[model samples]
Target: MTFKKINENEQQNIHDRSCMILVNFNSKELAAIKTVSGFAGIRDRIAVTSKNGNTKIKDILDGNMVDDNEDVWSEKAIIFNNIPTNRVTGFLDGLKKMKIRRPLTAMVTEVSIDWKLNTLIYNLKEERKAIAKGQFVDHK
Candidate 1:
């Protein structure tokens, strides 16, 4: 098999085509994010509900059909899949510049991809709490 090695920039470009999933955001907040995303050049996005909590991140990332019609905790949050490593700061900055309330943000990871949306949100809340306390590094 003749394999064409991808360069660093090429690999990054492949990963840069990202998708943003919004959870528990109101209409105004959704509009704000969609506007920001437009400026940031992230073309793909979706808003999901708690019912979607059980959907695997991988399925979402793969563009599989999402059935959020099913009834489904977290506050306003955003889950970023396949976002480029370097663009995170700029994206956040875009939100800050627009004076939009910051939502909890997470990038897709190997372990996280298997998690349902609700599971990710709950864990994110816990992690945030841990970081806020002095006991974030519990040795136990």
Candidate 2:
């Protein structure tokens, strides 16, 4: 996975491609927002707006933030499905090719398995309720 510096325009692109939200842990309300959005998985974009505001996406599979700076706080707007595997590899390759200075915390909004899990949970809850109330159960 590779991290790239994105401007507001790029941020908008990310937002357009997938569901996302701004994540700020420094403030209580923002943190709660993060929690809810994360649970929903509908918003894959995460913007960590606190501290230096410098952010980058971390590659959970690779276990790296994809940036070089460590002081900058990870204020990111995640793009869940924006970066595909090939694109991710290409990004890393581009960084190596250009010898660009990687940012501190990498920002990624790629869709995660959690999204499906959440959906499944929601479905199960609805189904359980239906069964409990005998709405869909066989009455005969």
Candidate 3:
């Protein structure tokens, strides 16, 4: 078996690395994500949400989501961790080129990494509602 070598900079726990967590994506959408990620040379950085949909964000960011059986969720979402802005832009552009439906997306933040998956998704939906009503405020 061939093992990949990681440098000193990558010696930190998995949370330090870039990751993209997909939640509730159908087979076609999951395939698209894999294709786009591979094209971006970040295929190893992709993950999927756990079947229970209650995994901690930090754990998800650490590539710890492991559900052997396929599960379903009402709304599809994507969460990104530690990815550079340019690469995120490129990934989104790639998705557009593939003609995939847009998924609710968010970047991991210091405050959000500790939240559970369901909690984060709830907040994101609320934020979207606020924005739709022109009541959204940027706290950052």
Tell me the whole-model lDDT of each prediction, alpha carbons only.
0.67, 0.35, 0.66
Which stretches in model 2 have alpha-carbon errors above 4 Å?
A: 1-81, 104-140
Which candidate would rank higher by TM-score, 2 or 3? 3
* Number of the top-ranking candidate, with TM-score as the measure: 1
Give the Å error, residue 10, model 2.
23
lDDT of 3 by residue, 1-140 (tens): 11121111122233576777788776877877999977766655454554645677887665576464343457778776766666666787788899887777777767677877777777777776676786754432
Give lDDT for model 2.
0.35
Backbone clashes counted, model 1: 1
TM-score of each: 0.75, 0.24, 0.74
Tens digits of per-residue lDDT, candidate 1, 1-140, equal 11121111221222343788888887888888888888777778878777677687776666563566343454778877676644555677789999887877777656677777767887667666666673343211
Q: Which stretches of candidate 3 lie over 4 Å from their true place?
A: 1-14, 63-73, 137-140
- Judge candidate 2 at residue 18 and give its lDDT: 46
Residues 1-140 of candidate 2 have per-residue lDDT tens digits of: 22233421142233234433243344654454445444444434444333312222223222222233334433222333343443434443444455533222222334332232222223334444565576652211
TM-score of 3: 0.74
Superposed Cα deviation of residue 126, candidate 3 (Å) = 1.0
Ten-residue stretch with the least lDDT total in model 3: 1-10
